[model samples]
Target: MMKVKEFMITDVVTVTKETSIKRLLEILVTNKIGGVPVVDAENKLQGMITDGDVIRYLQPKGRTVYDMFTLILVSEKEDLQHKLEYAIDHHVDKIMRKKEIFTVNPNDDLEAATSIFSKYRFKKIPVVDDSNKVSGVISRGDVIRYISTKLISDK
Candidate 1:
C-alpha cells in the first residue's frame, strides 16, 4: 500500500502565529499553496493557516443579500469587520483558527490519509515525524494525482 510519506511533499513552507498577514499572503501567492502549517520557532506544529483564514480576516460585518437563505444579525459591541480590519494590521493569532488540528504520521498508509481528508475536509494534511515536527504536507490534490497516475493509470 502507498504510504503518506511516499506522496507527501517534503519541503513544506510553514509560518508561525506571529507571521503577519502580508508575509503569509506572499507565501500563499508565491508558492501557490492553499495552506501552510503553523509552527513554533522549534518547528513544532502550532496550528494550521490557510487562504480561508485570510479570507476570514477579510469578510465584512453587515447585512448581506441572502436571496433565499436566512440572515441572522446579532447586536454586537464589536463587529467582525472591525476585528478583521484590526487583525489585518495586527497578527495571525487573532485571525488564525486554533481549533482541533488533525495531523498524520509519515508512515501512515494512504487509507488513513484518505480517511482524514474525508472526515475533516481539509485541503492539506500536515505530516509529522516522531518528534511531532512537520516533516511535510499531503494535500488532497496530491493524493488524487497520485492515485490517478499510479493506481488508476497502472494496469
Candidate 2:
C-alpha cells in the first residue's frame, strides 16, 4: 500500500495561532492554497484554517430587529469592507477550527487520507508524527495527482 508520505506535501505553509487574518489571507493567496494547518513554534499541529473560515468570520452580521410591545430596535447591516477593516488585525485563533481535527500519519496507508476526504469533504489534512508534530500535509489535489500519475499510469 502506498504511504501518505509518498504523496504528502512536505513544504507546508503553516501559521501560528497568533497569525493575523491579513497575514493568513496573504499566505493563502500567495501559495494558491485553500487552507493551512495551524502549528506552533515546535511544529505541533494546533488547528486548521481555511479561506472558507475566513470568509465566514469576516462576513458581516445580518441586520436584526426586535420588537417589545411598544419599543422597536433595529441594527443596520454592516458593509463587507467596513467589517474587513476591523477584522484584519484579529488573530486566527478566533476563527481557526480547533476541535475534531482529523489527522493522518506519514506511515499510514494512502487510503487513510482518502477516507477522511471522502467522509468529511475536507480540502486538506495534516500529516503528523507520533509526537503530534506536523510532518506534512495532504490535499485532495495531491491525492488526485498521485492517482493519475502513479496508480492509473501503472495499469
Per-model lDDT: 0.83, 0.91
Candidate 1 off by > 4 Å? 63-85
By lDDT, the best candidate is: 2
Q: Write the per-residue lDDT of candidate 2 for residues 1-155, one digit (tens) a residue.
A: 89999989999899999999999999999999999999999999999999999998867665554666644333334456767888899999999999989999999999999999999999899999999999999999999987788777898
lDDT of 1: 0.83
Task: List model 1 lDDT by residue over 1-155, tens digit each.
Answer: 77898989999999998888878888899999888998998898988889997886676555444556776564343466465556655667767767878888989998888998899899998999888899999999998897788776678
Please state the error at residue 41 of candidate 2 in Å: 1.5
TM-scores of the candidates are 0.81, 0.87
Model 1 CA RMSD to the hidden true structure, in angstroms? 6.5
| True-structure RMSD for candidate 2 | 3.2
